[model samples]
Target: MTRRPYRDLVIFARGGGWGVDRAADGYDPVAVIRGTDFAAVRSGRTETVPRRWEKRTLIVPRRVRPGDVLLEISGGSVARGQTTGRSLFVGPDVLPAFELPVIPASFCRLVRFDTTLVDPRYAYYGLLDMYLSGRAGDYENQSTGISNFQFERFLDAELLRVPPMAEQRRIAGVLAALDDKIEINERVVTATEELLRAEFDALAVTGHGSVPVTELVEFNPRTPPPERAGAPYVDMAALPTHVAGIRSWSHRPPRGGSRFRNGDTLLARITPCLENGKTGYVDFLAPGQTATGSTEFIVLRARPGVPPQFPYFLARDERFRGHAVRKMAGSSGRQRVNAADAADFRISVPSPERLAVFGERAGAAFTHMAGLLAESRALQSLRDALLPELMAGRRIRPAPAPAVTGAATDDAGSSVYAQ
Candidate 1:
């Protein structure tokens, strides 16, 4: 194994060339990926944002290639923290029909690897490990409130230990196997959600009746924190843009966040986050448990006869989101949705019998999706635990599949690791 400056492995690392021109939102109509889009990619979820609705852009536009790795460049957190340094590689699975050269916004940078010198997949996972391990954070420039990483400086000062190409491939394959199952499970969850949405659409067509959101659900209900500290706390980031559930949180002093109990839906009401679709259903907490999160959240809980999942799906719907975006009022960066406007928006309500039926179906589907999400978390834990050991030259194959799959052999007569 040999060590090399991080820069020697890349052909070019540059910031995005073009930005969203606010003046051209409708006129430009160009497809673009921004720092916000990274949230969807990171969560293994896909969301469609109309080109005309994206915020103002920079004049320069940098086209993305399939193999290029996109990294967030501007944010409060730097290279080491979960708040920043999120990376996603552009590939066929992510953009199968990517015909036109989609531009990257200024807040993102594209890093192209020299595949002849390194395996791209291996490099991606390696970078991920570095970030997770906090090794990458050592190179960050922390002169201001936001942590920033300069690629040129990182390449010059940082050293990457390169394993033999064969080992790199093997390491990547093992890790990717875990990721493949996670992705597969995510796809299943997405499909289930789409079905539920279809049912909602159908119910809307029948026109049982309609009521304002406030009439059907509680808005920002108050849940005063316990006299003590260390309650579960969730920031905006914990609520993913398109993911079905929250996978992370912290225990902190009860302070300054919208409070809610289990089964509540937390929908981001601020500019970029709202526009990006950051919403999460609260199921991770124990029964009767209460938690608080960024005040930017609008807490919605179903009223009597309404399914617990109703508010979650309603917040996730495109129409509701579009309406919220339209009602946002404020300065360029500080815009927020007017709570009154949101509460006043009319939502179609089904008849009691039909509502109960839809509730059962949607509840069943969500329960299954939550189970899959839990399994994916376990697989991710295994992959993360194995990554460092594999990168350090420890030769160990993954343990044979547990009886989870109900069979010892896969379709090819090999032992299955997972379904």
Candidate 2:
């Protein structure tokens, strides 16, 4: 509430430290979220994310309130609205790993701008731009990461050019509009998926007969051949999202891993990540390339008559995950599920007729969801592009977008500013 041209922002570490886990594909929030509590996050998105703990150097906000901006001074680059991904906190008396220092609340500084000086949303966009451009220029990195990465503290100290609040609002308006649309699209996809899955379960009848999923389908060996020297390792990072696909591949070449083939289903056999439904179906594995993944995922192939989508659907089911959780063993702190259990797990395979019917319905839902997912991703990209430009003085004329004018701001051209 200060009219001061410059305000102070404080960042600190609090709560406890977070634990990292191996997600199916990319890593999930092991350190940031509810410390491996996938069950809680799955049940409650916002609450689970916000209340989750991680004892990092918590960036405590100076005077943060609802609707105020929260910038992760440390996380290098972020999409416009998506920057506010998850809560940054730890439980009582906990601390981050001593090796990985977190952003202490003291490290943050608030930019106190008069409402007339700079709209906070607009400032956020500027911050995003600075973050990205800095990365591109390599200004944020200190020599190949062998050196310290101190962009967060540096940015906090760097000065920002504050424009009139009205202008900030206008610039923010356009960017926000795209973000709002993207958010809406994401919700639609999630709602539709949830509804379809719920309906499928309701229609599905429980038959007691059981068979190992491995037997019901064909299995492939994707393990990279024994590493001679510079060969790639089959780490989990190679797996893709949603359906079975490999987006990226690499050969670390240390361990003697096997290889995977096309149409093979990658079932994650690790805790936390396995619980998070980290499964991917390989559409194709380059000949002799031998795709690799973490010993975490159990790779398999569905036999003829089984839809490619069928494996994906079953792998994502909660029941399958529960079986995965039960099969896990090892240290309590970091449970490791074995590949053997995944290769020979019992599943409630419906009759062929039921499998066909359910597959048909699930297929429709997957198609619809896929479209929504693509669209949402596009909208998000656009929104991200405009965020920094509008926020920083990189683009746009000054002027707070006229507060959504039509009795209901969203419908009006200026709706982007709707509180």
Candidate 3:
């Protein structure tokens, strides 16, 4: 393997900047991938990516294409130890999933690899390896509260191992196979949540009586905080919008935040977070365990006769969300909905028998989703562990085996074989 400066192997272009304007003449609507959307996009969830309008003159130059990597060069939290330089690879398959032309937002830069010198996917993996290994932090410069990536310095300072083209493709194929499987699992999770929401909506319409939401669910339910030190802690950022399961959490001393058991639903109460649909079901903890999270969370737990999954789906309901938004109090960006106000939200209650049936159906779907999430976590761990070694050429593996019955393939039509 030969090492070369990162700057020599790729071209960098700034992303676009323009407010969304649907009726603007001579403007084209394009989906803009922001830094906040990195996690979801990486996990194959693109529904949350925002659409903005850009001048037609600027569209062609900033337009994203397959094989390009969108690198976050700005806006990261210094307090959270999340440095800039997160990257997302746009593969051929990812483009078709978007309804509008996609481009990186103003905070990101488009990294285009010179195909003659290196493979794009391989280059992306190299960048990912750098970030995961914490090497990218070396090039981070923080001012005020926002952390920005010193892209030029990083490109000039860091060196990447250039493997042979065949070897590059082979390595990318193996890693992409794992990613593909994880993505497929994400799709199933999304589909399952959608199905549960549909069923819940149907039940809500056909059910007998109307009652206050407090009748079926307890808001900010009182639960003893975790007794032990370093309990699982979920921040507002960990909550997912469309997904039922929380993707990440940390172990920290319980310091007086909203505490809940495994069956509660955590909903973001603050302005942008609430508006962004940040709600997550609490099922990742061990049996009988309690966890604490950000004070901004309003925990929703089902009452005696109600199903555990009911509160989560209800929190996801459009009308319920609208009511919560309307109930928001406080000044400007800090506005939040109080638990008391949210508890006042009303819903139609179904019969006990019907509730039980819906519980069983929703519970099964949630169980399957949990299993899929577990599998994805395992796959992600494997990929993270293998990334550094593979990119550094420390681990030399054989080329992927030829496609057999039902084996997956990459965008280039090459067979994918897991290591």
Top of the candidates by lDDT: 3
Runs in model 1 with CA error above 4 Å?
12-14, 19-31, 42-63, 76-84, 97-99, 142-146, 205-210, 222-229, 318-332, 335-341, 395-419
**How far in Å is the alpha carbon of 312 misplaced in model 1?**
1.9
Each prediction's TM-score versus the true structure: 0.80, 0.59, 0.91
Residue 418 alpha-carbon offset, candidate 1, angstroms? 19
Instruction: List, residue by residue over 148-187, the lDDT tens digit for candidate 3.
Output: 8898898889898897899889889878877787788888
The positional error of residue 226 in candidate 2, measured at the CA in angstroms, is: 17
Write down the TM-score for model 1. Answer: 0.80
Rate residue 346 of model 3 by lDDT.
62
Runs off by more than 4 Å, candidate 3: 205-209, 396-419
Worst 10 residues of 1 by lDDT: 406-415
RMSD of 1: 5.2
* Model 2 misplaced regions, further than 4 Å: 1-44, 50-64, 73-116, 134-156, 203-209, 218-265, 280-295, 329-335, 387-419
lDDT of 3 at 233: 93
Of the two candidates 2 and 3, the one with more favorable lDDT, higher being better, is 3
Better of 2 and 3 by TM-score: 3
Q: Model 2, range 298-371, lDDT digits (tens) per residue?
A: 66656677655666556666666676688789887578666666555665666688767776776676566555
For TM-score, candidate 1 versus 3, the one ahead is: 3
